[model samples]
Target: MPDRVNDTAAAYCRIWAERGVRAWEEEWWLLARDIGDRIGRLINAAPDTVTMQPNVTSAQAVILSCFDFTPPRDKVVMVDMEFPSMLYLYRRWLEGRGRVEVVTSDDGITVPLDKLLSAIDETTLLVPVSHVFFRSATILDAKAVIERAHEVGAMVVLDIFQSIGTVPVDVAALETDFAVGGCLKWLCGGPGACFMYVRPDLNRQLQPRLTGWLAHENPFAFERETLRFTTGAYRFLNGTPVIPAYYTCQPGLEIISEIGVPAIRERSVTMTSYLIAEAQKRGWSVFTPTDPAQRGGTVSLQLPEAATVCERLLAQDFLVDYRPEAGVRVSPHFYNTDNELSDLIAAIDDILADMN
Candidate 1:
C-alpha cells in the first residue's frame, strides 16, 4: 500500500471518533458515490454510470443476477486465463439456470482470440473475461472480444482488476456492458473496495435480483413492500456500504488520477521490458508477453524453485509474488525505480546460486 493511504485511514479514525453515527448523514453518505466519480474519471466513464461495491466477485454476481438463464441466450463465455473467482461463481450459481463455456489457453500463458470469439455465438448470454490475465499479465484484445460478443447479442462483463491503474482503459470507447475491478492491486488502494461500471443505457434496462435495502429508492423510508431500486449505479449496492474501505482507497485513487494512467503505463512498459530482458539474458523463461502492448505492468519470470525464490526475495525486502502456473511475478509500478528492478534480478541470481 502507498504511504498516503495511512493518512486517509487516520482521517477515517478521527471522523469515527468525533462524529460517530451522525457522520453517516453528514460526511459518509456520499462517499461511495464520490469514489465512483473518481473511478469514472480514471476509466473515461460517466460519473453516474459507476458505483462502489465490496469486491469484484459481488459486483459480478450482481451483474449475473440481472438476467434469466433461458433460451438461445443461455451460455456464458470466459477464457481459462480469467481470475478463478468469476469462473467459480458462474459455474456454481448457474448450475441449472445456464451453462459456462471457458475458452482454453493454448500454452497456459494467453488465450487465442479466435478460439474465444468462436465460442461466443447467438447462444451466448454473457462474456466475462479479464482485461489482463491475472497470472500471465497478458492483455487481451478487449475491442475484438467486445465487438464479437455484441455481434452475437452477448453482453460483456470485463474484469479490469489486473490492468486498471497501470493500463489505460476507456470504458466509453470499448462500449462494454459492465466493467468490474478493485483498488487492491494496481490502483494501490488496498482491499475491500471494488468498483463496477454499467453502461448507462444498460443500467436503465436491467434490475438485479441479488440486491439489498441500500439499492432501494427510499432506503430511509423503511417501507416493507416491494423493493424499488435506486436509479443509476447505486442499484448494484447491497445492504450497507463499506465506508471505511472507501476512506482508505481515496488517497491512492487521488495519486493515480494526478499521475495519469498513460504516464504510468509508459514507465511500467520501460521497467517491465528491462526486467524481462534481464531475465532472458540469464536463460530464464518469461511467462508474460514480450510485446509491450500485449502486456501490463507485471512480468512473470520462470526460474528454479520459484516459490522458494519468491520467499527469499520477500525476506530480502523485494516485494514480488508467485502463482502456481506463473513463477516469480515481478510487477513494476509508477512508484518503482529502474535500479530497484535491476537489484531484484541481481538478488534472484544470488539466491538461485546459493540454492544450487
Candidate 2:
C-alpha cells in the first residue's frame, strides 16, 4: 500500500470520527445528495441528473421497470457480452411481457457498436450496454451509441460498472438517458454503494415502479392515498440506505475526485498498457484492446490453465481476477504503480516457465 492510499484512507477515518454514525441521518439526505452531486460533477453531469442507489443492479432494475414499453416498441437491446445481472434483469422483463433481443458480437468478447445500432429500430425502447466488457475489458463507444440511439427515439442505458472510476465519463456530454455504476472495484468504495444518472429532462418521463417510503415526496406525512414521487433523480432510491457502507465509500469517492479523473484514467491506461506489453512479450495472447483509448483498467491475457494460474498467483500474493471467457483478468487501480505491475508479470513468467 502506498503512502497516498493510506493518507486517503486516513482522511476518511477522520471524517467518520468527526461526524460519527450520525453523518447519515434521515434529515441529512443531503449527504447522499452531495455524494451524488460530486459524482455528477466528476463525470461532467448535472447535479440534478444524478441519484444514489444501493447497487448498479438496483439502479438498472429501476430504470428498466419504469419504462412503458408496448409490443414491438417494448424491446430492449443488449449485447451478449453484458454482465449476467443486466442480462438476467432483461430476461426477467421479457418473461411475461416485453422482449429482450440480444445482439451477438462478431467476437463473443466484444460488442460491435454498429451491430447494436443496426438492431435498434423504432420498436426498440431502450438500448442497454456495458461501458466496459467485464470479462474482456473491451471498451464501448458509449457516446456514439447514445447519440445513435437517440436518433431513433430510443433511450440509452449504460452499465458503467467496469469503466466508472477507471475511465473518464461525461454523462451529460455522452447524452445517455440513464447510467448505473457502483463504488466497488475501481471506485474502491467498499461494497453496496452505487450511483445512477438520469438526464434531468427525462426524470419525470421515467416513473419509479419500485418505489418505497424513502422515495415518496412526503414520507413523514404518511399519506397513503397520495403517493407523490420525488422531483429529481433521487426518486430512484427504493428503501433505507446502508449508512456504514455509504460512510465507508465516501472517502474513496473523495480520493478519486481530489486526485482528478483524467490523471487516474491516464495512470490506468498506462498500467494496463505496460501489462499488455509484458504479456505479449512473453508470447501470451492478450484479449484487451492494444489501444489505450479503447481499453479500461482491466487487461486480460489468454492462458490455457487459467484456474490453476489464478490459484497460483493468489498463493504468490499477486492479486488478480479470473473471467471464464477471457482467462486471467488483471485490474490495476491508479494507486497501483508500474513496479507492482512488473512484479505481477515477472511472477506470471516464472509460473509459466515452471509449468513448461
Candidate 3:
C-alpha cells in the first residue's frame, strides 16, 4: 500500500516535472479547462457544459444562490444526512427568506429516495442530495429523484463528492440541473480544486452570485459598465484559479479517465464486499449496504469503542476516516486490493479482541 502511494506520487511528480509551472500559467489555463472538459465528457455531459470551481461547497452555494426563490416555489428540499457545509449554507440561506425542508430518513443515516421525492411538490425550487452518503456509503437513486423533481418543475442538485471516482455516474443521463464534486477524496486531487456541471438550458437562466474578473465575457477588455458574462458554464467561475491545485488534479483525473469509471465501480464493489464480509465474520456491526448496486466504495462499521479502534488501526498503518456519529468509515479505492481489505479486517479483529 505504501508502495502504491509512492508510485501514485511519483507518477504525479513526473507529469508535473514534464509540464513545468509555466505550463499552468495564463493562456495555458486552457490546459486545466481541457482536463475539466474531459471529466465532463467522462460523466456523459457536454464538454462545454462544465465549470471549474475551487471546491464542491462553493459550487453548491453558487447553484443555490443563482435561483430566484419566489412564493410557492421557495422551498429547497434536502435530506438530513447532507454534508455539513451544504447543510449549514442552506439553513443560513433559508433563515430569513424561505423554508428548507429536511426530509426525514427511515434511519437517520441513510436517505430513501422515495421519501425525498415525496417531499417535492410544485412549491419546491430545488432538491439537493448526495450521490452517495458520505458516512454509510449508501448510493442514492439519482435518476429516479431527478425525474420526479422535473415532473414538478423543480431543479435537482447533487453532491458527487463521495461517489465520483468510486462509482459510475452519468450527469446527462440522470438529467440533473447541477452537480458538484472535488478531487480531494475519491479523485485524489489536492484540496481546493473541484468541478461543477450545469445543464445547458439552465445556463442562461441563472447568474453567479460570486462574480469575478474570470467570469466576465471579456476579462481582458476591462469594461466597467459592460460586464458581459460567458454564455455557458464559464459564467459560474469566479476569481483567479489556484494553479497548483488545478495542476495537481490533472494527473488523477487522467488516471481515472483512462481506467474508466465502470471498471473502477466494479473494483470498489468487490473491495467493499470483501471488507464487509470479513468484518461481519468478526461480529462487527456492518453499517453500509450489503448489496453492491446500492453501495459505494466506502464500507462502514460500528464498534463499542469506535474512536479507540480507529486510533489503533491508524497506528497499524491502516488509513480510514472516522465520523463521530457514523463510526468508522473505510473507503478503498480501485488501486486498493482485496489483500489490503483482509489485512484491515485482521487489524480490526485484533483491536476488538484486545478490548474484550
Candidate 4:
C-alpha cells in the first residue's frame, strides 16, 4: 500500500474507535456511493451504474448468480489468459450451473482474437474476459468482443482489474454489459476495495441471488415478506461494506482522479516501453505486448532464474512480482521515473551476474 493510503487507513482506524455507533448513520453508509462515483469516472461510466464490492470475484459471483444458466444459453466463453481467480470462480460456480469454454492463447501471452470471437456462438450466455491480461499486460480487443457477443445475444462481462486505473477505458464506448475491477493494482486503492459496473438498463433487470439485506430496497426496514431489491447498482452489493478499505481507497482514487487516467496512461506507456526496450537490449524476452496500443502499464521480463532474481529484488526492497510463465513483472505507474526503471533493470543485471 502507498504511504498516503496507509495514513488514511490509520485515520479511519481512529475514527472507528472514537466514533463507534454514531458514525454508521452519519457517514459510514455513504462511503460506498462516494467511492462508486469516484470509480465511475475512471472507467467512463455513470456514477449510479457502478457499485462497490468486496472484490472482483464477489462481483463476478453476483453477475453469475443473476442468470439461470438454462438451455440454449448455458455457455460462458472466456480467454485462457484471464486471471486464474476468475476462471477458478467460474469453473466452480458453473460446474452445476453451466459450462465454460476458454479460448486458448497461442503463445501463453495474448489471446487469439479470432478464436475468441468464434467461440461466442448463439448458445453462449456470457462472455467474461479481461480488458488487460493479468500476466502479460496485453490489452484485449474489448469492442470486438462486445460486438461479437451482442451479435449472438450474449452479454459481455469485462474484468478490467488490470487496466482500469492505468489504461484508458470507456465502458460506454465499448458497450460492455458488465465490468468488474479492484483498487489493488493500478488504482493504488489497496486490497478489499473493488467495484462493478452495470449498464443502466441492465441494472434494472438483474436480480442477483448472491445478495444480502444491504441490497434490499429498504434494508433497515427488515422486511422479509418479499425481497425487494433496490434499483441501480446497490442491488449488486452483498453484506456490510468494508468501511476501512473504502477510507483507505480515497487517497489513491483522489490522486488518480486528479492526474487523470489519460495522463497516467501516457506516463505508463512511456515507462513500460522503456522497460521493454531495456530488457530486450540485454537479449531478454519481453512477455508483454510490444505495441503500446496493445499493452497496459506492466512489462514482464522473461529472465533466467526470474523467481530467484525476484526474491533477491524483494530482499533489496525493490517491489516487483514474478509469475511462472510471464517471469519478472515490472509495473511502472504515473509516479515512477525513468531513472527508477533503468536502475531496476541494472539491479536485475547485478542479480543475474551474482547467480552466474
Candidate 5:
C-alpha cells in the first residue's frame, strides 16, 4: 500500500466530521472531479472523456444499458478467459436481448486473437474483452481488435483491471470505444475507486439509463421534463459519489502517475520473466505466457492442491491469490524486489516439497 494512502483517507474522514455537509460542495466534490481528470490522463484520453465509477461492474452496466440490441446488431462477442463476474453478467443480461458468443481459449494459458476476431461479424453489436486477461494474463492487441470491430460496426469495451497500472495503455492510440479499470490491485488503493473512459465522439450519441445530476448539462435548472445528458464523458456519471474511497485512491494513482506505466511494464516483464524461468526449473506448470509482450504482471502456476497451498502461503504472509481456472497467481508489482520474489519461490519450493 502507498504510505500516504492512510493519511489521505484519514484526512477525508476529518473533513467529513468538521465540515460535514459543506464538504461536498466546498471540498469533496472537487476531489471527485479530479479523480476523473487523473484517470483521463492515465489512459492518454483527452480531458472531459473520463468519469468515476464505484467499480468496473457499474461502468460496464452503463455501457451495456446504452445499446438497443436491434434487428441485425444483436450479437455480443467475448472470450472464455474473461473475468467471471463480467462473463456471468453478460450471460444473464444478454440472454434474450442478444446472444453472447464466447470464443474459447485453446489452452487455458493463451487466447488466440484470430479466434476472437473470427467471432465478430455483422450481427455483433459490442465486444467487451480484457486488456490483460485475469486468469492467464495474456495481453490482447486491443488496437487490432478495435480495427476489426469497426469494420463490422461493433464497439469495443476494454477492461483493464489487470492491466491499467501495470501495462502501457493509450486509448487515443488504440482508438477503443471504452476502457474501465479500478485501483484495487496494482494501484494499492483498496476499493470503490474505478474509472471508465468514453471516446469523446461516442459520448454525444449514447443515452444510458444509469445517470444522475452529474450527467445533466443543466442540472440546477431542474429540467426533468426533458432528459438531456452532457455532450462529453461527464454523461457517464451517475448518482452521488463515493468521496472517502477516492481520497484513498488518489495517492495510489498519483504514485503510478509519477512513476509512469511504461516504466512499470518494463519492471513487470523483467521480474515475471525471471520468475517464469525459476518456476520452470522447479517443475511447476506455468500457465502465464513466457513471452513478455503477451504477458502482464502475473505469473499463474498450476500446482497440486492449489487452494490448500495458497492458504498455507497466506498464513506465512506471502500475498498471492488463487483462481479456480488458473491455480495460484503470483503477481510482482514494480514495488516488489527481485529478492522478495526469490524468497517467495524458495518458500514455495519448501512448502510443495513438504506436501510430497
Candidate 6:
C-alpha cells in the first residue's frame, strides 16, 4: 500500500461529511469519471471507453449481459487456468442458453495459445480469458489471442487483473471487444475501484440490457417515457457510482502512472529472477514461467503445507499469498527490493526444512 492511502481516504471521508448526499450531484461525483479517464490512460484506451465499477464480478456480469446468445453464435470459450469467480460465472450462465468450452492446460502450468485458438471456432461468440494466470503467474500472449479470436469472428473479453499493473497493455492495439479489471491488487488501489472497458467502435455497435439511469442519453432530462440508452460507453454505467472508492483509488493510479509499466516490469523481472534462482538453489519446485516475457510480477513456489508456510511468512512481515492449487504466490512490485525477496527466500528455506 502507498503511504498516502490514509490521507487520500481521509480526504474522501471529509467530502462525505461536508457535501453529504448532494456531493453526488454537485462536485464529488465527477471524480468517478476522472478515475475512469485515468485508468483508461493506463491501458491505452480512450476515456469514453472506460466506466468505473464496484468490482470485476459486476463488470463481467454487465459485459456478459450485453451479449445475445440466440443464434448459432452460442458458445463461450475459456480455459481451466482462468480465475474461478468469472470462470464459474460463465459456466453457470451456460444453463440451456449457450455452450461453455473449457480448454484444459497441458501441464497444469500454462494454457497454450494453440489450444485456445482451436476452441474458438466460428460458432464461438466470446472468449473470456485472463491476460495472466493469477496462481501460476503465466502471462498469455494477449495480442495473438485477440488476433485469433477476431479471425474466427469471435470477440475477446480479457480479464487483466493479474497483468494490468505489472505489464504494458494496449487494448487499442489488441482490439479486444471487452476488458475488465480491478485496482485492488497490483494497482495498489483498494476494493470497490474496479473498471470495465470496451472498444470505442464496439460501444457504438452494442447496447447493454443491464443498465441504469445514467446510461440514458440525457440522464438529467428525466424523460420517463423513453428509456433510451446512451450512444457511447456510458451505456455500460449500470448503477449508483462507488464515489468514495474514487478518492482512495486516484492516488495509487497516479503513482503507477508516474512510474510506468515498463519500468515497474523491469524492476519486477529483476526481483522475480532473484526469487526463482534462490528457490531452485533450495531445490524448491517453481510453478511460474521461467521466461520473463511469459510471466507477470509474481513467482510461485510449490511446498507442503503452503498455507502454514504463508502464515509463517506473514508473521515475519513478508507479504505473499497461498493458493491451494498452486501453492505460494510471491508478488514483487516497484516498492519491493531484491533484499526483501532474498530475506523471504531465506525464511522459506528455513520454514520448509523445519516443517520436514
Give a tens-digit lDDT track for model 3, residues 1-356.
22244555565567668877655463346644675787687778886778888878788888876866878789999988888888899989888788899987787557776778889999999998999988788888998889999999998998898888878888978889988888888877777778888898887667877777777887878777765887776787777776566656766777788888889988887888888888777787888889898898888888778999899999888998678777899988888877888888878878888899
Q: How many clashes does each candidate structure show, in the order listed?
A: 0, 0, 0, 0, 0, 0
Question: Across residues 331-355, which tens digit of lDDT does each residue of candidate 6 receive?
Answer: 9899986677778888988998899
| Model 5: per-residue Cα lDDT over 39-92, one tens digit each | 788889888778788999899998998988886899999988888889988888
lDDT of 4: 0.90
- Give candidate 2 regions above 4 Å deviation: 1-28
Q: How high a TM-score does candidate 1 get? A: 0.99
Model 3 earns a TM-score of: 0.92
Off by over 4 Å in 1: none
TM-scores, one per candidate: 0.99, 0.92, 0.92, 0.97, 0.97, 0.97
Worst 10 residues of 5 by lDDT: 28-37
* Candidate 4 wrongly placed segments (more than 4 Å): none
Per-residue accuracy of model 2 over 247-296 as CA lDDT, tens digit each: 66777787788888789898888888888888888789898889888888
Inter-residue clash pairs, candidate 5: none
User: For each candidate, what is the lDDT?
Assistant: 0.91, 0.81, 0.81, 0.90, 0.88, 0.86
lDDT of 1 by residue, 175-203 (tens): 99999999998888878899999999988
TM-score of 2: 0.92
RMSD of each: 0.8, 2.8, 3.0, 1.2, 1.3, 1.4
Candidate 1: clashing pairs of residues: none
Instruction: Please identify model 3 stretches exceeding 4 Å from their true place.
Output: 1-27
Question: Which one is best on TM-score?
Answer: 1
Model 6: lowest-lDDT 10 consecutive positions: 24-33
Models ranked on lDDT: 1, 4, 5, 6, 3, 2
- Top candidate, metric lDDT: 1
